[model samples]
Target chain A: MKSFLQPEQWTMAAASHWLLVTTVLLSVMACSSVPAPVAELAAAEQAILTAEQARVNTYAASELAQARQKLQDARAAVVQKDMLQASRLAQQSKLDAELALARAGAAEALAVNDEMKKSTEILQQEMLRNQTGVKP
Target chain B: MNYLKRSAPTAVAAAMSLMLLGACASKPATPEGVINARQQLNKLQASADLAVLAPVAIRQADAAVQEAEKPTKDQALSDHLVFIADRKVNIAWAQAQDKHAQDQRKLLTDARDAARLDSRTREADLARSDASVARNDAERARDEAVAARTAAEQERMAAEQARSGAEQDRLAAEQARNAAALSQQEAESANAKAAALQAQIAALNAKTTERGLVVTLGDVLFDTAQSNLKASSSSHLANLAAFLKSYPERGVIIEGHSDSVGDEDYNFGLSQRRADSVQGYLLGQGIAASRITTAGKGESLPVAGNDNASGRQQNRRGEVIITDAVTASN
Candidate 1:
């Protein structure tokens, strides 16, 4: 007994299989391509985070330096027998140092939260593309 | 069926390419952006609150500082100092009043002492004046007593002389009576003459008024301004004395007068001398000196005016005014 399927039908079925295999490979390649830029973007984001932390630390250090200078001036005024001016300067210096330290902590928290939100948005877009087999 | 089978793979390939492109284009929102937007909203709210309250707060602070400094700079401190000074002035015034009262008391005491001394001096002077007046009165009384005693002594001496003269006349009358008895006709003539004299004496005693005999010697009694009696005036006085001797109780007054022709003082002296001459003749005839009073009333009491010689002769005549007691005794 001989086979009944034609040679052209066999060629078409083989081409279809080849196309599915190529799409799967391309998708994986696209997914692999995302890691190089994503890795570079993550490094850039990390650098930006370090720069922001440095700016916050510099602001905190500058405020602490100004507070220390003011405290010294207030002590000098007290030595000169000017209690009213000394008390006002001491209170202003303490409030400015505390506000600068709080603002530095808030900037560091905002940087870390921004990095997590970018990573989650990339993951959710990948999931939606896999389930629908369509463009976003 | 053939056409559907020919387009199915191509459609799936296109859908897969679109899904991959969409996945690559998606971007995520960051927390830094959300926080920056919230901070900007809070800064706007703060600016609005500051705009509402700034002008009112500045005005309130300025007022509070001004009120705190007002009490230390007031301007009336000098008036308070003056009020305190017046208390010391009042004390000085009280002391001055006390000193003035003491001075017044001393002045009054001195005035009283002066008045007492003046009164004592006046009383001493009055006592001396009264003693001088009393001495003058005593001297006047002594002079009056001496005059009265001299008048009484003169009367006593004249009465003694008249008694002695009367005894002598009695002896002479007795001798005349004896001589007349020797001749009878002579004795009868003497008795008749004695009887006539006795009747004249009785008639003088019967009269109660003033009475006396007026014998006018006329111009034959004396020369001009001379007090001598002529021999003819003497004989008439002798007869009058003889008649007066029979009546011892009868008194005689001899007076002289002068015309208004000479000085009144000289006429008075001439009249007094003429009266004394007549008194002397009566004494020679043995008339008692105690029974005669001699006086001169100078040309003052005149019976006639001195315009004619007859009137002047009448004014120059003498007069005798005998007292009633003497006539009654005669």
Candidate 2:
């Protein structure tokens, strides 16, 4: 019984070693041919530019700054030869910039709507006064 | 399911391997952050306004949510996916909110325009009312001025009439004053004449008889059987002429008388000549000839009998009679 359990334990250990080694070898081979996330980095840079053109910093300052930081981190990941992480970071940076732009647009739209409502209210009050004063 | 269906060499080996791989080999539970992100995405997708407004962003968020939901061995990769998914969902919702506000702007703009138009119309009406009020005030002022002009004209006419009436009254008063002065002068002259006539009658020693006032001239005034008056007797006859002239309303008759003892025709002639002399003297004294009448009487009537010579002498005389009497002031 001891001998049977011993052989089974040895087989499990060897199989685990083989699986680890194959995973490492495949990862190394994949890394040697993988390119930098050039398109994603460009897309993120373009999104940041669009947000700046939209004046996102004035309304969503923290969000725009986080997007810039993410872009820088993405570039660093590319130099470290971590293509998958670099791609994911570039996508996150673009989304961050997009988020900043979206939040700024919402804030500006809300402010404009508020001003329009206030103007309408003032005109309505003025008209009310005119009617009441004359007719009363 | 396929691995479970395959026959194993021993029950113990299959059972131990299943137990050892149970915690890790089973499908990984989704992370709490990823679940939250998916829930948020689901909520946004349920909204028709959000889905229509931000379709592209919603689709991107869906993709990120799916990626985060993927079973992975690397926790860091899972966490990054969850982070991106969370941001993507928020961004989509924010974009949808902005689009919604933009869409609502149309209604707000329309309302504001309507209010502005109402205000402008009311202002135009107010301007018209103000113009009407101004016109009324102008008309009132014009009417007031016309009334004032008419009143002033009436006052001017009244003043002119009063001035003319005052001038007429002044002229009448002046005429009345002139008439009163003339009447007073005539009355004074009448009074002076009456006083002088009274004085002349006293100097002549006129007697009031039954017939009239008579001034008697004695026989001594003329010479015996002569028609001429004596020079000393001329003084007495002069008073008679002045009295007659002063009382021009009175007339006098001069009568010469003689005694019965004288020759009848001779006495008559002598008496008649004596009266003629007295008349001639009065004519020279400025008395009118029509005011004097003279006659001669030869003893036709006598106051004494002819038995005594003194009686005959007293009976021969000349007399003057005044016919009328006039009171002084009347």
Question: Largest lDDT belongs to which candidate?
Answer: 2
Fnat, model by model in order, equals 0.00, 0.89
Question: Roughly what TM-score does model 1 have, to 2 decimal places?
Answer: 0.26
> How would you encode candidate 1's per-residue C-alpha lDDT over A1-136 as one tens digit per residue?
0022234434564456335434543454455542122222222222223333446455356655554565556545444444444454554344334434444544444444545455445545544453454422
- Which regions of candidate 1 fall more than 4 Å away from where they truly are? A1-136, B1-213, B321-330
Tens-place lDDT digits, model 2, residues A42-108: 6777678679879988899999899889877876676676779888898889889989999999999
Q: State every prediction's TM-score relative to the real structure.
A: 0.26, 0.62
Q: Write the per-residue lDDT of candidate 1 for residues B265-322, one digit (tens) a residue.
A: 8878877888888888778777777787888877886778988887777766555444
lDDT of 1: 0.51
Question: What is the alpha-carbon RMSD of candidate 1 to the true structure?
Answer: 50.6
Ten contiguous residues minimizing lDDT sum, candidate 1 chain A: A35-44
TM-score of chain B of 1: 0.35
> What is the per-candidate TM-score for chain B?
0.35, 0.55
